[model samples]
Target chain A: MIENFKKRFQKDGIWVLFLLPALLIYLVFMAAPLLDSMRLSLYTGKGYTPTEFVGLQNYIDLFTNPVWRERFLGALKNTVIFFAIHMIVQNSLGLFFANLLSQDFKGRNFFRTIIFAPATLSVLVTGFLWTLILNPHWGAINQTLKAIGLDSWAKPWLGDENLALVTISLASVWQWVGMPTVLFLAGLLGISDEILEAARVDGASSWHIFWKIKFPLLKPVVGVVAILTFVDNFNAFDVIYAMAGAKGEPGYSTDLLATFFYRTGIAGEHPIGIPNMGMGAAIATITFVILMTGVLIWLYSSRKNEDLV
Target chain B: MSRTQKLFTYSALSIWAFVAIFPIWTLIVNSFKPQKEIFSNPFGLPQNFTLEGYKAVWLKGNFGTYFLNTIYVTVISLALIIFFGSLAAYALAKWNSKSSTALYVFFIAGLMIPIRLGTIDLVRLMQFLNLQDTIWSLIPVYVAMGMPISIFILTAFVKNLPREMFDAAKVDGASEWRIYLQIVVPLLRPAIATVAIFNMMKIWNDFWFPLVFIRAEESRTVALGVSLLFGQYRTDWTRALSTLSLAAIPILILYILLSREFIKGLTAGAVKG
Candidate 1:
């Protein structure tokens, strides 16, 4: 067997042997499932019943029907809101912390570790922790607010319709801020020390160094981070499900597309015993399209820039 | 740095640190308090702090079983990722061919498409294979899901390595397998570690897979188990808090301990991509 493999390798057969197994598994499990879901979306039927070719009816109903349209648009609006807040808060704070931590200061590592800790845990754990901390009846957030003479500011953050989604986004931003911060920091580190020294010798302040010199150079990394945040936020389910739940509770205030799909397509109390697999697949397809479009646009621009470079 | 700015910087960092960690701190402190007292004064120490919450959650909540199950799934999935991912990555990195680009794209496709999209069929497939309610079911799913990114990163890292190393090995009449196993594998330690740590955190934190696939008591990961505990006692914040603490302690400690490697992996992965 070993001699035979030596012959095959001499004949340039190693790539075939190496790539086959992984590709086979990915094709079967990943590509097949994705394609199968799209195929499933083309058919509509009740649970355990025979199905017929519905063609584009499902897509039409999704966009045209009032109830589905309202909920779908609502989820879209809420998701956009979630992504917007994260882009502003998460990225800005990430840049701020990255800048601050990059400075020569005592206990910087300690602060970095502490700040990055939430990013390590599952969104589930962080969501649960914040839920506990913001429990209106017994949460420390309310306690602190009361202590600071802002007692009226406290509410059941996860339960209030007005605050639930924003609160959940903030929780997500907290868990994921470390990622963009680290990305920005890497970009910061890549800037030459001599360049910074040159800037410093020219009498530029630290703020000027960052805004004028460092920020523009960090644009590529920031672009990558922004697109990542956008895609992840669009598909974000774990934090919302963990905090607000599958129905996107508190009057469906926190209902993003992912959770809405889970409820409508995957896990809700379908009147029938079987799930609405097609409707769920439709939701998943929409999410996939939106996310892939965002990613492809980013990649296209980045590739063009790389070519110019 | 000026003296005033130095002091101001340290002070700002400290305040942010305190704010960043306050939620978990609150969870620990509140876990000891009785349910009645939690609502009254959540900020202060309990008048009669006790071990009742922890004791109840540990014994009644069955966190031990959940922890063991989580460990089994995470460790096995990570092992599969390292072994299978590196082999594929070796071929993709070393063998520059038209097919390798396609193979790379094939794997890259898996990254953009989230695995949950196929839930309708995946659940059916799992049931057909009799893997529902089993921890083993998550292994292939995770391996397949994680393969693309791992291979992508590993290929990039390996491509960056000096070409002379592989040449040196081959000049010694080393077999292809020998070149990969002996030379390439050793050199890939940091990349493998980065991939392992990244995948480990993700696998441990995953909740949707367990909720969708595992229905039995022995199959539940910590995240799923904690969610179940929350469901059981929706109004019982103290018990839920205790369960949360049990779930969070190990991960939080691991984060603090190896944050440098974790951050390095994260930044490299993000920036390069």
Candidate 2:
């Protein structure tokens, strides 16, 4: 057995040379920091370095401390709303667009390219552009509304407290709808031509076939798209930072958990203007937990779905 | 399909097409107009065109430096990711061992758990290494962030390769490196393209790392530059729009030229998973 092991090692030892660079880099930069950040969360201090170890205190403060609690809860609420908008609006629009593109049609490639062009641009650029376009006075949307004699419909998109989060979410949806569209389109196109032909031969209407057949077939892609959307939205930062400022301005209505983490951990909350590294790490740890929960749930449900199939 | 169904499809698509294009059109077109003209005629096709915005951004701002900095970082990071990623993936594919399998799972886990959560610690690491304010800071983080997806895609591709080729090369006394160069790489071109395009988009468009690590104008990326420009030129609509347009036009042109590959590359994960 020892000889056999030695032989295997002698033969495949080149694998070590192949694996070391990536493994070393991954361990040092990614895996180490991720775990160490959790360790750092137990400590609290000012500026970039947290020297004091106060176990569970930062987490407690995040939950119960008045100043921290309001911002924490507000960011949490807005993040969920941001996530919900993507799940409903973004994914629905993606599915609709994908279904439309699935059928044979004219200018199909042109429409596909047009729909996806925005996704190539930076989120920062899109956020800033939309903020300009959605401006209350001379921006395109409001001006066009006024031009069409719907003057009363013109309102501040990024300026109002209640509207800011939703507006930003929609702008993000606009940028990324291509992801799900392409994913869903791939799935739709994978449906066998024979099955679609059979449906047509059975005298089923196009609407009936799309709903009863194509939509059901798209369940797996839907799962993947929703999970991707959930993960992306929770981690979203650039949009709010660009459009509403890093503070998630307008009374912090647009504040998502990521921007909250940025404010608390990296940039430091204003006035005192010192980063609370421990609290930041704690926020990250919580975001980590949330992401893991979501992914595990998705995995379990998808596996169960496969078993049923 | 019926005539009404065709009309419905075309019109519905047209409305969304309009929604998608209008903002981008205004962004590009209005960048050419004078400052006040932008606000005065927000949606029009620049009746009085000028290169003033572009000139200001290019000549005065550090826009050119930022563009070059972004290109340098993106190219170097992508090269490292592909090099390290492909090597690791090839071994994991060929080395039938419990440890190899475990390592594959370890890397793949990163796909779900974002590398952003590790930012605070990474910042500390960067400072410790004296890289906090330089372009070098972003390289390791992006390469590390990119590893999981690259390995995930490339490993799956490698696994399906004909096993007999490796055995044949082995019998012929070809060293593993030679075999990898002469054999695996030739076939891995398309998959490499897939991996390259996938990570290219993320690294090029990324704002978070540059935001966290770099502060100096010489080291700032395009995304960072745009954010700073927005703040500086907030009241100057033409310059602001021009900055955005300058940063965006290259990507738009690239997407149009390589739409098929871009679409395939961006959505490669869906197919792979």
Candidate 3:
């Protein structure tokens, strides 16, 4: 066995050498930090200095303490609402647009390029740009509304607590709708022409064809899109941070897990509270688990459905 | 395919397209106007097109430095990610060992994991390595962040290639390194382009890492620099708009020039995965 192992190692040593650079970097920088962060969650501390090894105390506080629990639950609720908004509004609109673009129309490429253009720009630019447009006084959105005799519809979209979360969600949807649209378009193109032709020969309308044929065939892509949206929305921070600041302000109405984790971990001091690194690490670990659970559920369920098919 | 349906499609598309472009159009148009004109005639054509806002951003805001720092980080990170990602992918694709499957699964699992969750320890590690507040700090992090997807894509690409090509090369007495560098690397162009475009967008627009990792002004990326600008000059719409345009326009131009490839690459990643 020792001689056999030696021979195998000699033969495959060069292949191992090829994998070394990427594996080393990934293990050290990505994988190691993930494990360390989870470990850090076990200890309670003021900052980076953990004073005590309180096992799962931080996680308990995350659920029990009034301030921590309130923020944690609020962030979780908001994160769900954020994901729901994307899944409902963004993905639906993306499908609609993709269906429209899939038609043989003039200027289809132009329209596709224009719609996807915003997704390419930095979130900082998009966030700030929308902030200006949604500005109450002289911004174009309000001004346009006033000019069109619908001044009552205009309000401080990003500032009012009741509307802030929805407004931010819509802004994110606007920027990222292109992602699903393109993915869905690719899926639509992948549907076999023969299947569509048979449906057409049977006198199926476009809407009927889409509902019965295209939508069902697009199930796998839809699963991919939903899971991607789930991960991205849960991990989202930049747009909210840029538009509403670190506090997810207008009273934490727009706080998601990512922003909440940032404020709790890094900001350390604020008017509302002080940062606890242990609590922050705990939040991070929770976010990680939630994301992993989501992806795994999607994977297993999709696989099971595939087996059924 | 009827006239009414075509018109309806065009109208619907036109409206949504307008919604998509309007904010960016407003930013670009307003950036050219003076502050007074922006407030007075917000949507009007710029009566006086000036470079003053761009001038302030370029000269006063030190955006030029931020731009260069971003380019430096992005280029170095892409080079390392492509080289190492393709190499690792080649091994996983061609090697038929039990460990290869384990290694492939290990790397592919990074796809679902958000690297931002590990930011706490990353800061500590950076401090330990004395890489804090330097461009070098972001290089390894970006490369690591990008690896799982790059390797996944490249491995699929490498697997689909004619196996006999590699065997022929091996029989010709070419070293493994030679086979990878000369034979595999050139054939992986399509996958490489896909990986490059995806990584470029992520790295170039990434705001979180730069916000957390780098503190010095000189080390700041353009995205971070633009955010800082937004914080400081929130009310100064003229300069703020210009700064945003400066940050966004280059990538916009790149996307327009390579829209077909970018779309193909992104959709390929989604469909294949």
- Provide TM-scores for the models: 0.95, 0.98, 0.98
Per-residue lDDT of B1-273 in model 3, one digit per residue for the tens? Answer: 889889999999999999998888889999999899898877768998878988888887799899999999999999999999999999999999999999999999998898999998888788889998998999999999999999999999999999999999999999999999999999999899999999999999999999988889999999989988777778878888999999989999999999998898889887887
Give the per-residue lDDT of model 1 (tens digit) for A1-309.
999989857766876777777777677767888888888787777642216678877778789999788888889899999999999999999998888888776788878888887788778878877777777866677877887999899887887899998988888888888778888878888888899999999999988999999998888998888887887788888888878877778887888988878876667444553667788778888888888898889889888887887
Error of 2 at A21 (Å): 1.1
Residue-wise lDDT of candidate 3 within A150-195, one digit each (tens)?
A: 9899999998999999999999999999999999999998888899
For model 2, the stretches where C-alpha displacement exceeds 4 angstroms are A1-6
On TM-score, the stronger of 1 and 2 is 2
Ranking 2 against 3 by DockQ, winner:
3
lDDT of each: 0.82, 0.92, 0.91
The regions of model 1 sitting more than 4 angstroms off are A1-10, A48-50, A270-273, B37-41, B44-47
Stretches of model 3 off by over 4 angstroms after superposition = A271-275
**What would the per-residue lDDT of candidate 2 be over residues A64-183, giving only the tens digit for each residue?**
999899999999999999999999999999999999998898889999999888998999999999988888987888988999999998999888998899999999999998889999
Candidate 3 total steric clashes:
0
Among all candidates shown, the one with the greatest lDDT: 2
Model 1, docking class: medium
